[model samples]
Target: MVPDTGKTLCADTIRPVNLPEPVAVREDAAGRPLMVALGRRLPVAAIEDCWRVDDEWWRARALSRMYYDVILGSGRRVTVFKDLIDGKWYHQSY
Candidate 1:
């Protein structure tokens, strides 16, 4: 036996968490991030890692990005990425 609460589960009711947000990044001549604007500008201390992702190329809207894991001057680590298709920057957490 089961009780009906008049509720349903569907994709429409689902939402993404920790989706990347647009960010302001200042890059050097070599196209490396020097500073990033969170609330204010924060200098990048070091680039710990870098990688690229190019997926779903057969789709109408493909995904392509260059990701960087860096340490800020305040010793906080953050992940940022450049959208290769749109030339935009974003900050994300993994």
Candidate 2:
């Protein structure tokens, strides 16, 4: 469970939120995903961490994702994930 530190938190229940959003991304020459656009193009001030999850690969609808914890230019921190199976982006919050 995500700690509630005066910020939005994801509940323990596993719900379906399969919505995908289009975000403008800034990348290094090596093509690493850097800045992600929340509303406007914001530089990635810092990437707190990152991780990958691969699940249900045997099923027809599989789950594969790469999640990043980042602080935006405006200092708003958010957790964003890239859908590796479909190459899309999404933000998670309460």
Candidate 3:
């Protein structure tokens, strides 16, 4: 769970909210996100958690997602992931 920040999210629950517009991201040496473009470029304040999932390998389009739970410079928390299969980034919450 995330700390309370006055957002609508319940302190003990996470929900998926797909990005209306996917943003471009700049990664650090270890391939962790350092900045994200959401309306404007916002630096990542910290990464709270991370994990990976690889599925549907036998399908024509497989799923290889690496998700990162991060806090922005403005103190807003978001979950973003890289689609390893397509090499793109998207913001989501779980």
Q: Give the TM-score of candidate 2.
A: 0.67
Candidates in order have lDDT scores of 0.94, 0.77, 0.86
lDDT (tens digit, per residue) of candidate 2 on 49-85: 8898999989999999888788988898977777888
lDDT of each residue in 45-79, candidate 1, tens digit only? 99999999999999999999999999999889999
The best-first sequence of candidates by TM-score reads 1, 3, 2
lDDT at position 61, candidate 2: 94
lDDT of 3 by residue, 1-94 (tens): 9678887757679754654346699999988999988888899999999999999999998889999999999898988898887778988744
Locate the minimum summed-lDDT window of 10 residues in model 1. Answer: 1-10
Clashing pairs in 1: none
What lDDT, from 0 to 1, does candidate 3 have?
0.86
lDDT at residue 53 of model 3 (Cα atoms): 93
The candidate 3 region of ten consecutive residues with least summed lDDT is: 14-23
- Identify the runs in model 1 with alpha carbons over 4 angstroms from their true place: 1-13
* Model 2 local distance difference test score: 0.77
lDDT of 1 at 73: 93
